[model samples]
Target chain A: MTGLPEPLRSRLHPLDRTLDTLETPAVLIDADVADANLVRWQQRCDRAGVANRPHIKTHRSVAWALRQLELGAEGITVQTVGEAEIMADAGISDIFLTTNVLGEAKLARLGAVASRCSLSVVADSAEIVDAAAAAARAAGATITVLVECDTGGGRCGLADPAAIAALALRIAGSEGAKFGGLMTYPGAGKRLQTEQALQAAIAACRGTGLTVPAVSSGGSPDMWKDDGLEPLTEYRAGTYIYNDRALLSRGTATLDQCAMTVLATVVSRPTAGRAIIDAGSKALTSDLLGLDGYGLVLEHPDAVIYQLNEEHGLLDVSRCSAPPSVGDRVHVLPNHTCVVTNLFDRLFIVSGGRLQGALPVEARGRSI
Target chain B: MTGLPEPLRSRLHPLDRTLDTLETPAVLIDADVADANLVRWQQRCDRAGVANRPHIKTHRSVAWALRQLELGAEGITVQTVGEAEIMADAGISDIFLTTNVLGEAKLARLGAVASRCSLSVVADSAEIVDAAAAAARAAGATITVLVECDTGGGRCGLADPAAIAALALRIAGSEGAKFGGLMTYPGAGKRLQTEQALQAAIAACRGTGLTVPAVSSGGSPDMWKDDGLEPLTEYRAGTYIYNDRALLSRGTATLDQCAMTVLATVVSRPTAGRAIIDAGSKALTSDLLGLDGYGLVLEHPDAVIYQLNEEHGLLDVSRCSAPPSVGDRVHVLPNHTCVVTNLFDRLFIVSGGRLQGALPVEARGRSI
Candidate 1:
């Protein structure tokens, strides 16, 4: 073949205009709704006499994290050291990494970020504490360590309260480590058990003559019940800002309160009862948190995205009396907002049914 | 606090070095195995007297697409106009966009792409054909249109063979449009039915005095049985390049032939039978595809990743005779490799247990 012509640049119409002109398969975040959610959570935490530390993993935008901090959040919580690094580079001074930082290489990376920011991390074992301590010493940084206590969550954490205290004490005795407190991501709807577990861990720490600086417990499902847990000095929640179908199913937030949505266009209607959309597992995500479908279709409430390929959403329109036609736009509230945020590199900030600006997902794909 | 020291630059070590020093949650592709898969598939298609057009949606890497073309692939197939744009920019001449292009904006974008490359698309409806025709005429381009016939996939496609032929005739008669052929993504284990469906559609096209230039049928599960279908002159398969666990479960491929694996690290051991890895839904993807778990632990054959959060994979090691420890590196074979490729920004190309280079997933996040 001869020399080819100049290839056209496929640019998705910018969100600088109205939402009607924006492209499909785009992540649209209602900034007003997000701000309202932020203020509501802040006021709730203030009433409960607790600190509000929103997890940055939900949005992963430095701009949004700054907004949360401006809205009276004490600090930010990150899931990965990579996220902490990104936030610290953006001049954030306080960050709490909720995941356990193990391995010498990772702890060293964590120590580098902790040196610049008042960083605290959760550890469930003695090996993790020792690694963090050594890394902090090498960096000449004082690292705060929170012993992760597993109340009912079957994920990572120390189940024994005494073990948590022992780990905290180990942090206190280490060269460059300070015992911050206890932190637990409680199981869904296990508020009472989480409170009891944190209380026992705090008592065990007190018995060792170590004052726990902050006792943290978090889960969006039980965010409103923070006042019932007397020992928790702080609450960290990521999904509350961009509520999803999972939270909606739990009645934690109303559908109107959901801030994030996926804007998709009906590309094809193969059958009378089936419509294919531009968004699929890549755009909407495949996180089925015990919900009926992948997401909630806003335009056609009864329609279900029963299946998804990598690029096409299989919309089951059997339940919809009047289903969407090809070329119609639709909004999909994903089942889990956190995963959806990480799936896209940019999100369109929309408010009042108009486009604001695009926010880059700075910490997206920072899994390490 | 006093003025903090200079923040260390956070760098997830690049794949320029060996694979042994690579980071976790990294998508690693064995170049040798991938090239072998390319040659094997090409040879299989040649033996069956058909053209091989592997879908670039699997890897979404322009470099790999070029390599496939270099290995005797007739052309490449993409799932989106965004993908077609990227492939054309990389000097790829022939591209078959498998999804229907609808709406004025998308049709305009599709026409722009068609102007610079030999672009072909599949359509199941007359509206799609009319849109393509109008867009091509405006762009001064001749676009090839393929009628998509639904055999049993129940996704996007016309179920009626006569309807497919009618759409083909419309394309043949439309301004700046050419009737390319018929296309169908056969359902898993439904190759015979897909063949019958395509044969009927081709017959209908002939009855309408329109010659179907190319009859295409594809699916990774039924790729080996393509020779059984006599009417097909072209075959498209994507997942065959990077065989996933779902394909392995379907008995389409063995574990050794799987070219793609998510390299993760054991970050925590919460219980004796549970090890939490750094790779979660964001890294490994939660596409179960009706499998036992999220993915297969390649190191620990009996261990199952029973649960996953956005950033943590819960490993159930009860069935394993020997389990991995915290900080141990493990390779996970994702259930669906295509989605896994879209989740990451770059992939480490490994061969002979050493990192060769980094392949950018250029077409990733191009769902629009």
Candidate 2:
């Protein structure tokens, strides 16, 4: 009686109350699993002598961000200026924006947010560094700039060590900008190349009389396989807090360890093999992340969500002898729960099978 | 001159202001194109003598729904109870809920909203019909119930015409429910089967001495090619407002007719053939809808958005003769514009390439 757990005998408990009282298509954050996840990651980083700066995009709740801070996280990492502003408003002092800040409007916003908090951003190009420096000077604030190295990731970053060092030197030379360190997503399965690139970039920066104080590396898929560890001052990961199927499929996190689960009700059983649930692409989201189905049905492991409309999840239950009927509730572990957080307004918090309350997902869809 | 277009020559216009002043990763709705779409669809439905009940889920906007009503839309269609409540709250007199109402909480909500507006719902199961009737009776409201038919759509619906008529007869007999008509999504490329099912259902209902007033059909993919209109009293279409790449790929819509364009900035041109934009799965969404890439970059038709992280859209520009550089903006036609509406809080409205204002996507992510 797990995954889509059977209704508890005790109706007074919060979990049963949630299942019984709340409408379908609700996001439930199991506090026990989430708290354990937070503690486990923080301890791992502490053991490695590295600062754990959790990315807020996964949970996107100020309450969880504060909880991570209480667990002794060094700071917080944000991908957009809107996230930094929101987290800063909630008194999160140290913020690191991982995306390259481009354009005049965004640069001006970056400077404003920097003035409000101890802010640092990544830069892979000299033009970005110059623009940030200019914006910082105009706002009467000094910005800490990190050189983003491509390492093995095919996304944004300078692939060449010399270019990373040169960009670091350029930032260090700017009066309004201070060269902070190096940052990279470090494409998974290319550890040797990722480490080598960072080490070489550090030596190149040192050759130019630029001191590297902090080096950040991240990517949840390869976070736990720390064989020897890279030359990292800190590690940033968002999905560690509420593991999804992407982590589960990789054997990184077990089924019981996943904190967030989507609770949906079977709206129709059109055929013997098909059961349509209230949760759809808008609720669970369509981020497959290289998985087979949309999410994992806890009650029936054989069930596969073959398709989704805007408000319906089509589950092929042909293989399951005991399938969910109309009005039967099923708990689903979303393939990628990060996108799920941004899909809803609030998440139901459950502890000890009792509904504690709900926390608003305030930073959701803050794509500006 | 087109997508990801170069800055407009006239900066004083609202469209130019939106292009130059607004931040990247913004959703822009072209009024001229959108208005043309609305009028064209409305006129088509008028000529067919079918009521044009536009689905609000496409835009998830109250302003747009009101505009549609002003343009002679029979009534607005909603997929979820939350959408119905919101539209009803906006003084919308009539609302049709397409999804089946299951469970006590949602049924109670349905009855409450029915009390507020001329509310109707679709039901394929006897249990849903009974539960909704009981809820309506308790709330002192009569919910107009439409029998949902499968009609080749493998999702939620009663496939057999006799079963559809049985459900309609049951609703007609219920004191708290009224037999409104029949409804089906009518899965694309199955017109003959869809019409046959509807005609049979209507005959079965007539044999049962139940009057069928409305026979509603909807599906945006094959909407334009009406070989011969079905026996429908009303038609529903959502994506026709802001045509997307999915419609464009199928030749249902042309590139020039796409109204909703994601305006994103090129944050990094990491290599000669790769550029990263600020818009990712969160901004543009990952709904391929049988399309090739994430979106169609208007400026570089050959460029492909191969992959997406949370905040980065990776572009493969090796085949493009003139690729966009850093700080350059790109107007992207999303793979599916419906999901994109749910990803933003406010969509910027553009007229004559100028920023008219913004409409709150108030009904977005209302999967309740």
Candidate 3:
């Protein structure tokens, strides 16, 4: 849609029609499907009496993030200060940054955003808490600090509940900073451990005369079960809004629920058993996510994208009873959809098989 | 560089001199190292008496492409028509698009680029040739068409020599196109096979009264061996300019020759044996290239980036003799540098351990 010509615009079809309008290897967001996916996830949270705070990392579009907020999302979650700034610029008032915010540069930016919104960040160490407090004080803003408990994620967070409580107390005592609560995005099979760690940290903080205002826990695979985890005030899940092949493999969603897909054209058919698609690592992404192939070709489900160069996807069609030919467009569900969203500058929004419009990936490449 | 604050800009460091300025997870390009890499690759081609045409996909920076041309590169190879258009806008006249150009929309764009520059493209079938010729005729521009031969890559090309000749003859007979000989990016360890296939195709074309003028062949691994493939007038290599971990693993480049690296800060030291860097799949990329890890930790060569989320590189530092602590800046040589280049919006240019400036990845998401 960025450089799409007028003549080709008419041939663009979001449905299963011949994709002749837009160029091959385009990220197509089925608006109807995406809307349904969003509504379904939000409704599940609502039915369970829990707040659905969607993570903007899945879409990285300010428009869609605003849409989620409009759909009764309590707030939104982001991974970086840049993303939080983007959301703040879009007038999203309440935002929670899930990653540990460190460095004077990042903290200063976070403080600036905190001045304009109800901004909160996670911290697992006193060093980061002190840095955030100093930045917040310099900016004359109050920053909410959530102690990130490891809970068996084995990534980032305090492994011990005492460490988490100590960090929270340190944040409360630091200038221009307030203790928010505890947060953790645990591994797929560590939900119980994550809940236990959060509960233990909350009890320890309460014993020190500090109130745990919010408890945040989320992961798309365990999103539905988050409501069962006591003391979790909010749930944040990103990929549930646009279920991918990884989610589908985890039985989190079905193929029909995959809202975001890469529309690729078979550029070359070199052999009877093999074909090449224009969507390669650049489009589908190199995030294998332990999947066998790069993505699942929706048109020929049996086709295995066994190889990917920078701009070419090598499809082994030996398993497919009917393989695609050159010029035929196919839909690919990437193994991981979040990284795919970052790779594109724009997403062609389609509704019920028609190209509606395009949305800029506003927060894309805002990794820092 | 897009939204970086003035204070934060000075904090960026690729080495361990207290990374307080530019934020972590930045793409750092050492100017001296990059210039040396460029000159070294060019000299190798010059000494071999073959034209060096570096692929623009490696950096996708117009300024860098111009530098290659200024440093005596014959022409630059691009992976997309959009890239060629970008090069043309930058006053780069001679361009060869390595990928097969198809679809009316892309052909129209290709024609627009050809009208502004001396442009040639590869094709394995007559359909693409006819489409391209039609578009060229419509634009009143003469375009060169190269018959892409398989030559053991088995990706996108005509396998049979007779089939290659047929396509070459078709291009020669086309009204708005001229035959520009054969081109192939051969597979690893297939230089002899590529040479024989090219010879057979050339012989077949000559028997049909078509004179093949330029035989273009390339692969970074065998770039130095192109002179051995007789009649190969031009050589194209992408990764030699940056020299990723994949190239280093293959012994194609030494550590000193590697010019590009992602500078990341150790944001979380969760355990004694593990540290989490700010750079992840978004910065370092997930292209394993059959490597054991995501990237080579430059500061600690024994460190392995065992896991990566979107914005977190989980580094296994147990193998490191003196493991890095939180807030330490470390340079990462990504497994595939080209993909890493595509992920960032800007590259922080460095000269002798100091930040020089930032260069925009102008052609970052021109995947369409």
Candidate 4:
């Protein structure tokens, strides 16, 4: 075998100019939608006199975080030390870690990241505070520690206001550790509700006589109804940037404002009612049941993804007016945007059906 | 801060010694169990007089594939061009891509990979055959093309035998392509059924009037059955290396023989009956419903993972003998082994409570 010819290139036909031509199960992020979504949140926070610290955990891309900063975000919130490290490397100065820092190894890594930037993390227990303090001192870094309040999230944070204040005092008393303020993630169920509960929680924090200079409280679902944010100086809303099916269900963002989507191809039309796609658990992510399916078929909303294999995405096309053919590509908006972002290595940023830039999910698999 | 401290070395404890201390929702692959599983499959194939071509899609590790080859596997099988490329780079000689090769980019990639090894692929349609032939010619290499028959999989392959034979003839006539044999995946439903049905399907391939050099058939669920392999010269089986909940449910492998497990920590015991862990969709993977939960609690079988958040795994420990306390680590056998393997970047091979070697999931997240 000598003098080999060049391989065939996929001709960019006229029909391929549309979104339908791209490969199936590919992630799509509409920049316009994301931009509008970012602006809307910025406007809401501006009107409420609260700072917007959009969480980078939703996208895990420095480019997306920079876009948020460009749209008037004060800072950004990251969940892990790895995420903070990546963002700090990309020149993101302010970062708030919402999870508890545990273990000496993780705390040391967190301390190194905190030393590089204006990093602050939450401490729910005294043990976690001591660990953080030791790591911060060892690194010769002054790290801000936030007293995470359990505002019904039931995941982390102290339940009692006095306990939160005590943890804050413990961090303040420790060398190389400074008390930041209070932080809380109102459970998903209460995120869309009125701010009556959140206001009460803030009042309770004030009742403890602790100077809660910066109270961070915000979720995508109820960011619009944040009228009583006089207590919360900064709002950490992540999902508002790329609203998902959950946000849609909560009436937070319209379907068009959803920035991210999975582009999939109809690989098999097995039965009259069912068609199988190339996207499955490995692509779409098996994160559903409360919602109708894993995601909504953008062009064919009537079609439902009933079953999913590792490689085969089973779609029920019986309800559709026009079923997808053997080689038709479909767009899917995943139920959870954050989980979907972790599944891919890169994201294709397209505008007007043209390839713009390929953004890497810098913190794709930083689960630790 | 006058002097910055040196970067702390990663104190990542060995998996074997740290099994008791390692965080729960962790993945553990017992080398002993894996070796036994591999030897069992090898014995099954040897007794059936069929060459064992273990699919590396299950493990996606060269070390695991090499172990299978050492146990008497003829070669390896892959599903994607990316996966084939990884295996070829790892010095695997023979390979069979069991999926339809399509488009210019993928075909080109497949052709480049085919040139490096004894590569072949399955085709169900004329379009796929043309694409493969074009790629092979462009790469100045020949690739053996197998006509895929839809014995009942209903995902890919031609349903009719005449159509399969016709596609086989087309490949035989095409330049840079050779007609190999017939390939069919009998779907997951026929996996645990009697061997008579599989035997008939293998026998039906003989009547195609084409020289059947190989007849590949075998799934992890039915690896024990050998009567079906009488007419087949080769067996393609994956997932026996790491048995999962699905295989255990089908009585294919016992719990003791299952190699892979997820180690997780109980992060929140919010209520008396409900406990939440750190490993959720991001770690454990949400691939359940038909089986038990997403995974089986190795220590607490009675506990049920009722709900899974993006970062939290909610386990209902109401029926357990003793509920695990907060920070207690536990092992979970994922519902599906293949998807779990894709979730992690590295796997620590443990033997007798000691570290052996770390295997990188080289072809992980290579969905495209």
DockQ, all models? 0.55, 0.73, 0.68, 0.31
**lDDT tens readout by residue for model 2, B22-103:** 8878999887798789889999999888899999899988877887898899998999999998888889999999998887
- Encode model 3's per-residue lDDT on B1-368: one tens digit a residue: 32323222343333332324778888888767877888888887788778888898998887688788988999999998878888898899999998877777888899999898999998887777888888789899999999888889888988798888888989999999999989998888888888888889899999998899899998888765544557688888988887888888888888988888888888888888889999988888889999999999889999989999999999899988999987888899989988999988788876666676776777898887
lDDT of 1 by residue, A231-293 (tens): 889889989999999999999999989999999988899888999998989888888988898
TM-score per model over all chains: 0.95, 0.95, 0.94, 0.88
**How far does residue A156 in candidate 1 sit from its true spot (Å)?**
0.5
lDDT of 3 at B316: 90
DockQ of 4: 0.31
Q: For each candidate in the order shown, give its overall lDDT on alpha carbons.
A: 0.85, 0.86, 0.84, 0.74
In model 3, what lDDT does residue A298 have? Answer: 91
Deviation from native of the Cα of residue B74 in model 1, angstroms? 0.7
lDDT of 3 at B244: 86
Write down the TM-score for model 3: 0.94
Stretches of candidate 4 exceeding 4 Å from the true structure: A1-25, A160-176, A189-204, A226-231, B1-26, B189-208, B269-274, B318-322
Who wins the DockQ comparison? Answer: 2
| Lowest lDDT block of 10, candidate 1 chain B | B1-10
> Residue B272: error of model 4 in Å?
4.4
**Which ranges of candidate 3 are over 4 A from the true structure?**
A1-19, B1-20
Q: Please give the clash total of every predicted structure, in order.
A: 0, 12, 7, 14
Candidate 2 stretches with Cα past 4 Å from truth are: A1-17, B1-17
Query: Tens-digit lDDT track for model 1 on B1-368?
Result: 01111110011224445666666778888776877788899998888889999998999888788878877899999998889999999899999999877656778889999999999998888888888989999999989999998989888999887788788888999998899999998888777788788888888999999888999877788788634567888889999998999999998888989999998888788889999998899888789999999999999989989989988999999988989988788999999999999988889877666776677888888877
